[model samples]
Target: MIKFNTKTNQRSDYLPAASYSLVKQINSRGVYSFCMCPGGVIAPCATKNNEIVTNGWSPSQRNYPTANSGIVIELKVDDFKKYSSFGPLAGVEFQKNIEQKAYKLSNDSQRAPAQKLLDFMNNKLSRNIPKTSYIPGTVFY
Candidate 1:
């Protein structure tokens, strides 16, 4: 991102550069009319907390049925405002590493370590399986 310090951080206030009308509505009017801005337009976007933050939407228009929705990656201060010593790219680096880790962890290769009831019964626990990351209650290991 362009690293905004404030709404007035003024990379010019209006994107698309050539357009000033949007800037007039947003900056001059002071009423940020974000169109159906995701979920709440603004939620607790916490990247440092190892949370998969997100939001969603459904329209009231013809193709819009009011419905439910769904929702990454690690990000640290060092990788953001610190490491790489490159300002915003630090955050990019952090996200890259987190994505890599997530991909590696999720590579089940169509054969996760699940066992049938008979197999589970036949085996005794000599090593501990990891705690499942699934929500609700994870199955017993």
Candidate 2:
């Protein structure tokens, strides 16, 4: 995994549990992994209303071949300068836009946009994507 951090603190010996309790406030953004599923499969996380979101969960034994984590980046008031006119609702608007854009880019389907790991880092699109654990599947974009 590609870890990005400049911290020198060693991680706790305890097995990391739910991320809901952990909050990292940086640049007015609450950065945390939403659901951490070790040895789990990525699930189709769209709501009944037809919005695309991704989530993962593992069995108690965590014996699956794959593991996934949903990292969430929350925007704070300062990050909504362009939408300051919306006041407190700016963040909501921004999130809605992101979901809508993802739906549109994926041809209004449940398929999620995906790219090769190396291709993504090199800023290039892969001609083909490897198989994924995502059930709804992914469309290389």
Q: What lDDT score belongs to each candidate, Candidate 1 first?
A: 0.32, 0.66
TM per prediction: 0.25, 0.63
**On residues 1-141, what C-alpha lDDT tens digit does candidate 2 reach at each position?**
322232853333333444443457766667665666655787776654445776677876565656676656685566667777788888877766667777777788888887765586478997887777887778887
- After superposition, the stretches of candidate 2 with alpha carbons farther than 4 Å from their true spots are 1-36, 48-50, 70-79
- Give the alpha carbon lDDT tens digit for every residue of 1-141 in model 1: 222345553342322212112212322233221333211222222254333332333332212212222211223353355456656577666665554443343351111232233345467532433332222211222
Candidate with best lDDT: 2
What TM-score does prediction 1 earn? Answer: 0.25
Model 2 TM-score is 0.63
Highest TM-score: which candidate?
2
* Error in Å for residue 121 of model 1: 31
lDDT of 2: 0.66
Among all windows of ten consecutive residues in candidate 2, which has the lowest summed lDDT? 9-18
